[model samples]
Target chain A: EPEVTQTPSHQVTQMGQEVILRCVPISNHLYFYWYRQILGQKVEFLVSFYNNEISEKSEIFDDQFSVERPDGSNFTLKIRSTKLEDSAMYFCASSELLAGSGELFFGEGSRLTVL
Target chain B: GQQVMQIPQYQHVQEGEDFTTYCNSSTTLSNIQWYKQRPGGHPVFLIQLVKSGEVKKQKRLTFQFGEAKKNSSLHITATQTTDVGTYFCAGRVSSSNTGKLIFGQGTTLQVKP
Candidate 1:
């Protein structure tokens, strides 16, 4: 089955450094999203992207966080300055534009670690 | 934004016993999705329930959506050791079509052989 792929299975960065996580969604999917799961916590929605623009975002997705679909296949999330609380498993997901079916296909996830 | 709540934060059962997890949404939902995450693994889609009072069954698992579309349940029959994992119920609001999933805290199941 075709699946979403992400780079850097794990990353370690300093508290004030910039970090970018990359993802390549399923070729035919038009809606993309970014979610995070803190250790032993619930999965939280960060942002959703469609038509090259963000459709919705949560409070956690503040000015320091940004997402881009620089190309047809690549979707990236960048954090200007990483905070200790920002360390979590960041997941990239995509869904076909089918109505009434809100199934999400998620990637393996990128574990971000800030020190 | 709608929130989903799952009951029994954790469950422990024998291999031959049955297991069930309940999910309740604060508001009406357009659809409810179920995902399973193994230890140290990412979430994998199990099924999605749309429409009021819908019931769907897999080989040994059954899912139900409440009549009000605000609650759902997942039941496993004769659970096996392989059924050990965390199950999450995610809901999508009726007003949104952007495919954003609001996930619940999840129910972790432990099966003893």
Candidate 2:
């Protein structure tokens, strides 16, 4: 089965530095999403991207966060400035269809560590 | 705001025992989806419930959506060692089609042999 794939399985960055987490969603999928899970915390939605624009975002996805589909296959989440609290496992997910009820396939996740 | 809460943060049962996890949302959901993530792995899609009072089964696993579309349940019958994982229930709001899901805290199941 085709699955979402994320790059840099683990990332470590300095506190004020920028980090970009990359993901290649299923080739045919149209919608993409980014979610984060703090250690031992529930996974939290960050943003959703479709048609090359952000569909929705949560408070956690503030000024520092931005998502881009720079190419046909790559979906990336960029954080302008990392903080200690920004450390977590970031997951990229995609669905075969665009509906809210469609099944989402998630990547193994990129563990971001900020120090 | 969408809030999904799953009961029994942790469950430990002997092999062959039945295990169930409940998910409740503060608002009506357009759909409810279940996912399983083994320790050290990512969440994997299991099944989705779209209609109110809908029920679907996959082998030993069964899922049900509440009559009001605000709650759901996943039951695993005759659990085994392979059933050990964290089960998460995610909800999509009725009017949102952005594919953004609000996930519950999750229920971790430990099946002892």
Candidate 3:
């Protein structure tokens, strides 16, 4: 089956450094999302993207965070100046229908470690 | 803010035993979804419930949505060692169209052979 793919399975960065995680959603999917999970914690929604713009975002998605569909197939999340608390597994997901209206296919996730 | 809560943070069962996980939402939900994540793996979609008091089954697994649409449950009959994983329930509030899902902490199940 077609699946969403994420780059950089693991990343380690110093606090205050910038980091970018990339994802290639399923070719036919129109809605893209970014979610994060702290160790042993619930999955947290960060942002949702559609039509080349952000459809919605959560409080956790603050000024430090941004998402972009830089190309036809690439969706990227950039964190400016990472903090220790930013360490988590970041997941990229996509769906053919509207966000919650349909099932989401998630990538294996990019584990970010901030020191 | 809408929230989903799951009971029994962890469960340990012997092979062939039954297992069930319950999920409750702080607000009525438009829909609820279930996912399973194996150790060190990503969450995989298991199923979605969209109607009140709906029930669905897949092989040895069964799922139910409460009449009020605010709660749900997943039950597995005659569990096997392959059932080891964390089950999560995610809910979407009826009032929002943002498509954001509030996920529960999840119930981690360990099936022993």
DockQ winner: 3
Model 2: per-residue Cα lDDT over B1-113, one tens digit each: 67999998999999999999999999999998999999989999899899889999999999999999999999999999999999999999887767779999999999999
Q: Model 2, residue B55: displacement in angstroms?
A: 1.1
Candidate 2 per-residue lDDT, tens place, A77-101, comes to 9999999999999999998786356
Find the candidate with the highest TM-score and give its number.
3
* Per-candidate TM-score against the hidden true structure: 0.97, 0.97, 0.98
Which portions of model 1 miss their true places by more than 4 Å?
Answer: A98-100
lDDT (10s digit) by residue, model 3, range B24-71: 998999999999999999999999999999999999999999999999
User: What 10-residue stretch in candidate 2 chain A is worst by lDDT?
Assistant: A95-104
Worst-scoring 10-residue span by lDDT in model 1 chain A: A97-106
Ranking according to DockQ, highest score first: 3, 2, 1
How big is the positional error of residue B101 in model 2, measured in Å on the Cα after superposition?
1.1
Candidate fnat values, all = 0.59, 0.81, 0.78
Between the candidate structures 2 and 3, which one is better when assessed by lDDT? Answer: 3
